[model samples]
Target: MQNSTCHLQPSLATSVALPVIYSLLFPAGSFGNILAAWIFLKQAPTKRTQYIYLGNLVAANLCVCSTMPFLAVYFARGYQWTYVSTECKITNHLGTLNMHVSMYVTIIILCSTAINQYATLKKTSDTQYSQAINENFYRCVLKKFRQPKFAKQLSTIIWLTVLCITVIAIIYNAKEEIEKDSKCYSIGAEANETTAGIAAFVGTACFFLSFTTVLLSYYCLTKHLSKIQKTTCIGEKHLIYSTVKRNILVIQMILTVCFLPYHIFRPIFYVLLTDRYCLRLNYLVEIKNFLTCLAAAKSSLDPIIILMLDKTFKKSLYGLFTKSTPENHQCKADIFTEETSKM
Candidate 1:
């Protein structure tokens, strides 16, 4: 006879573990995201094209974090949800929507940054091939595509597309009945095999697409930087190289730590569950849950990443946190002046 404890152990561990994790995540994520939003709003005048995408990213993370407390409550009660079915469906839908939005927006920002860097490097270099390309190409392609207005338009399009898909998901999930004492779970009850499989496939596809784009962007940027290092003076090379490298490092860190693990495991778990192979693969299920938690942690980590990477955001955040004085106020003005000069 199979031991019932063996059958129940994973659920027991999940029920005990996730609530504790979510509890810590909720406050931390909330504070970080709120601060990010506030800083971005205050500094919107000085914002560049990437900052628009980043602001949207912050909003997406904030939306995701807002739902975490409810998730913690659901997990804390041994996966049983006393909330209405509508609430459960909305929470689940919002989570999915924001995940996609965050990944896509990050990819957009990386691509934009890569293109700008490449253009700058090519223009400054003495390479014959780069100069052979006419001004028309630069004006029609790079300049047109990389404009700040285009980024705002792209942001609008992304939100609209996400909203359309989320509405579809919400409607699809709403058809199912939630039993009176049902557990508000992601897999077994809320989503059945077909829905879960579709979700996993979509998630896997998005992950690959975004991951490939980001990888290629960073590769090209690195290659360009290497060429620049060889050609440019050492004094000028260090500052530019360090800045690009830091940005690339932060992007790669977010992808590896938050997004990669979840996408890798999510599809496997769903396919196994759909085929009724999950009984023998309980360990993978636990791993998938852990990855999901990591994905959620991205909301908290993103604000810190912004502060680390953006001088303006860091200065603004520092000003907000520290005591105000004439010297500090003057320092802030100086930073703003320096940033404007760069633009």
Candidate 2:
């Protein structure tokens, strides 16, 4: 009986676990992203392109963080959630929308960083890199993509689209079986709908497409790094090569840890969510729920990642917590200088 049918009974995962996890993640994400925002916003003049990407990333994380308290409220209710309320639907819609936006935007920004690395390594000289920036129409478009204006414009478009979608979902939401089960986030009988299925399919497709592009870039970057390693004449610039390689690898690792599991299982979970899949496979829904939480947890982890990945940001963030003293400042400078020389 246990082998043939998985238990659908309530457990700590839905009732107690999610809220607890959300509680832990909320403060971490808030503190980290807030620091990140201050850092990026202040440095816009010097590093406009990086600021645009990372600033948006911080905004996306904050969006997720804002939704967590409400979601934690819902999940904490647990077995009591027999019927969905208007508030439930609204919370569900807001959480779902923010999660997807965060995922998609992070995917693009991280991939762009990798793609830029490939572009950087492709140019044999500083002259080539500078000349390559506006060499032709396509390059011009790519160049525009890296600018602050384009990021602002695109961010506006994404939020506007999300506003439209949220309205549609709220107005048109029908009570499907899964929603009746108080499982607001899962893809179930709704998957049978052409419109919903198409949306799900498109999202899954986009993730894999972006994943492939990043993987290809990572491979090419590795080859370039290897070539750089074989030459001893690069001198101090070898640190740049090492940093680039580390960043690319860390980006891939972050994607795998934060985003991969949910994406990998989403399609299968989508099918299992339908009316045809039966209650026996209901356990998969719990698995999917945990993965969803993990995806959301990326926001909480982003600040720590930012601290590790960007030294200037790390120093600035650390400064916020420490006493501001000239001797301490000199000590930090000396420490950084020593680390840089060692590297």
Candidate 3:
């Protein structure tokens, strides 16, 4: 499998369409990831370690987006490899690195977000970060009996940990056998399929657990919010809390739907078709690549959702676009809210 070579001749229509799609999506995802990272950094949480998780999520998304140009160029050239073997290795390494980090970060974020949401349900006006911090603080005291090394600087520590892990993974993966003829290359060997399968299986299991936790948390939060809304007057707190809850729920829904189609079908399709077609599965290959690209859209679409829906994010983004005149800067500025709201 390492030395095998095959040519791809996609339909002209597809050739044209795929490049256009890739070109547009590449920048969109890149910008979105940057915006997300900025939002997390600019409006960092004061208490909960969960902000660390959120920062990791944004950073992972950025890492994923960084591969867009390489992928776009490969796809645009009809999946031809024009780069050197080292470049190919690096590209594959970066892709795998981003993927692993992103998956783990997603799991962590979901778990932390669930705790945050549950806290909101328990304390109506105290905020989620406060609740998470209080719970983690006591948990630390009970378990380690001392403050964790990263407690105060959890966000920075998480970021550094992700960076270290990602770099190591890339180096290890890149050292694997490289097929010179392939223009667009990736790490790992089909001979090691079992190991790859196990890694993917573990990652998938973690994803499902995280997804389930997030869904359940949102369900409980929504139910509680509905009851509160009906019984209590809709005041400033009600408005903001409701908005935050809604925004996060919508993001969760989008992630669920976007990720489901590929997860449900990719493995089954590969198993049924790969034996017969072997590497001659041009259509299937294209479909797989397209799905991968589509998945990349999440990074792009997420920031848009934040800016459009989240009041605080919108305010920060508006600040970026606007020049600060003293009069205008202080113009009540309450177009929405003032903070980098997290998910």
Candidates' RMSD to native = 4.5, 5.4, 5.7
Most lDDT-accurate candidate:
2
- Model 2 C-alpha lDDT per residue in residues 1-343, reported as the tens digit of each score: 1122222454677768988898888888898788789866653233344455667778878988987887677677533543365655655666555566556766766766665555544443233466666666655654555555776676677667766765765555554433345443333311334545566687778777877877877887778667766764767667666666677788788788877887888787656554444443556756766887988888888888877886666776677688989986776666556433332
Model 2 clashes, total count = 1
The candidate scoring highest on TM-score is 1
Off by over 4 Å in 2: 1-9, 43-47, 82-84, 120-126, 129-146, 174-196, 228-232, 274-278, 322-343
Tell me which residue pairs clash in candidate 2: 188-273
The residue-level lDDT of candidate 1 at 81 comes to: 46
Candidates arranged by TM-score, highest first: 1, 2, 3
Candidate 3 clashes between residue pairs 3 or more apart in a chain or in different chains: 81-183
lDDT of 1 by residue, 1-343 (tens): 1111222234765677887887898899889989889887885443465567678778877766876776565555534443256555555555444554554555445455545444444433434564445456653454443457876887788778767776776686677564455445534443356666686687678767766766765786678777767786647546655675567666766777788878877766655654434455556656766777787888777888788888888888878878989998788778777654343
Over 252-297, each residue of candidate 3 has an lDDT whose tens digit, in order, gives 7765776655555556544544344434455655565566566666
Determine the C-alpha RMSD for candidate 1 after optimal superposition of all C-alphas: 4.5
Alpha-carbon runs more than 4 Å astray in model 1: 1-10, 81-87, 90-145, 177-183, 274-278, 322-334, 340-343
For all candidates in order, the CA lDDT equals 0.63, 0.65, 0.55
- Which 10-residue window of candidate 1 scores lowest in summed lDDT? 1-10
Q: How many pairs collide in each candidate, listed in order?
A: 0, 1, 1
For lDDT, candidate 1 versus 2, the one ahead is 2
